[model samples]
Target chain A: MRILGIDPGLTRCGVGVVDAEGRAVRLVAVDVLRSAADEPLEQRLHRIASGVEAAIVEHRPDAVALERVFAQHNVRSVMGVAQISGLVLRAAAANGIAVELHTPSEVKAAVTGYGQADKRQVGAMVQRILALESVPKPADAADALAIAICHAWSARSAAPTAALTPAQRAWQAAERASRR
Target chain B: MRILGIDPGLTRCGVGVVDAEGRAVRLVAVDVLRSAADEPLEQRLHRIASGVEAAIVEHRPDAVALERVFAQHNVRSVMGVAQISGLVLRAAAANGIAVELHTPSEVKAAVTGYGQADKRQVGAMVQRILALESVPKPADAADALAIAICHAWSARSAAPTAALTPAQRAWQAAERASRR
Candidate 1:
């Protein structure tokens, strides 16, 4: 099954996708959702949402994986991140894509066998696991890929009979209609 | 002097501009930057940047005001807000506009005479201050106008000299050349 992973941010979001069968997974695409510094937050979120939807449309992934927001020291900052995540989740939900959220530690542990791996270490682990020639540039991009990889592994081991919820199914139908 | 205020967010960003003369401020424009829920963040940021630049070009504001990001409880969320703020700052710096930042509490206090005013109260304050018949739609949009109003009150009172800083002078010359 194909899976899309996202690392959502206000200024830039990283997206990656892969297909998995058993222990094997193949990279499909990876990209960064970027926003201009001067634009309003709502505009930026919309841009991010659009980019993610376009990617989903292009890839037609079976599932979407996103990193969960963790507690931080700043309230305003957390609010913004939550907002970005909200948009990401909304986009996936609108498309009827099943979503799985992994904490940073879970993603790190899944991808690197450690929960607190530094960015560079994670990058190396991702490259090694994905069998890529070089590390993904812009750390966020690599993190996005890692998130995708984590999902692929988790889904492969999970039950397959679990189907999309009715609401999700309806959304998928609506999304399909819109695409047409 | 003209001051532009921006309330940045992921879904909808409100932008407002006003002319400041000592304590008096006159509204110039107030609008929202909107993006679809499915669009990517990068494309959205680009659009936002373009929109802000277009507004700046049209209004030729003397200064720009932005809301300072307050601490949030989520690390990822804070990062996203910071990213948005970074883009906003970058856009202002690129245009050689004098940039000022105000806290949410500060803006609220200036506009509503209370630091903890609710959205509706703030909207009412904006309408009253700007002599509008109705409240600004979309809370974010009204917040943006409030930010501008705050700048007009505080930043304008402690006015910077008319002479441009060295960096601003260089940027202005470059901008002029580009225009020609």
Candidate 2:
């Protein structure tokens, strides 16, 4: 299975794609979307959305994973973040892709064997697990890869014998036919 | 002077432009950018940035006003919002336009004469101030316009009496020349 992990932000969003088979996971792509300083909010959002869509199309992941939003002290800021999340969710839904949301604690626990691991620790764990030459830079990119790793681990652990349901099987058949 | 207000989001971002002179403010443009659900985040951001750049080029606003990020309990969510804000700031800065950031409460107070005003009240106040046929739609657009109005009021109240300093004058001349 291929999984796409996202670290969504307004200024820069990090995305990572990974292919998982049994216990092995390999990184497919990792990149960031950056917005110019003078761009309007609406315009920036468009660019972000477009970049995400392109990534999804390029990777064609079986599942998409995202970090869930937690509550905040600032209502306005929370609302804005919620709005960003809304877009991310909508984009996933539109693609008819199943999205899995994970909390920071859950992602950390899966990646680093701790629920409250700091960024550096998480980065280290990701580097160790992915066997990368060095840690992913910009922190966001590492977080995105970590999210993908967490999803692969969770899915493998939870569904040893899980396969496509009858409905999903039919849908896949239809999709294959349509593509041909 | 023309001021543009932006309400940034991931899926939909609202933008409003208004002309300000002394105590008077007139609406010029109000629009929202909608992105497809299946699109990539990077692509979405690019679209948003380009759209805002177009608007800026079209309106040639004197200043840009935006909502500031406040503290949030959700670190992940706050980070996402911060990313969006960063893009917006970048867009503005790239165009040599200064930006003024406002808190949600400040925007509410400026638009509705109530720091704790409800969305409806704020919408009504925006309508009243703009003398429009109706309140702006999708709420975000109205809120963006309200931010612009707030800046307009603030700028008028704190109008400068002296002419631009020599350095300021030279900078303005260069900016004007660059545009031409």
Tens digits of per-residue lDDT, candidate 2, A65-152, equal: 8887665544654444444555565566656566778888999999999999999999898888888999998898999999988888
Query: For each candidate, C-alpha RMSD in Å?
Result: 8.4, 7.3
- Model 2 chain B is weakest, by summed lDDT over 10 consecutive residues, at B155-164
**Number of the top-ranking candidate, with TM-score as the measure:** 2
Candidate 2 chain A least-lDDT 10 residues: A155-164
Question: Candidates' TM-scores?
Answer: 0.52, 0.57
Residue B163 in candidate 2, Cα distance off native in Å: 5.0
Question: In candidate 1 chain A, where is summed lDDT lowest over 10 consecutive residues?
Answer: A155-164
**Candidate 2 residue lDDT tens string, B1-180:** 679898776567788999876557899999987666577654565566567778888998888888876654446545545545656665676577777788889999988888899989988988989999999998988988999988887744225312457687568657756863
Write one digit per residue (lDDT tens) for candidate 1, span B57-149.
898877789888755434544444554565566556656667778999999999999999999999999998888889989888889889998
Candidate 1 CAPRI grade:
incorrect
Worst 10 residues of 1 chain B by lDDT: B155-164
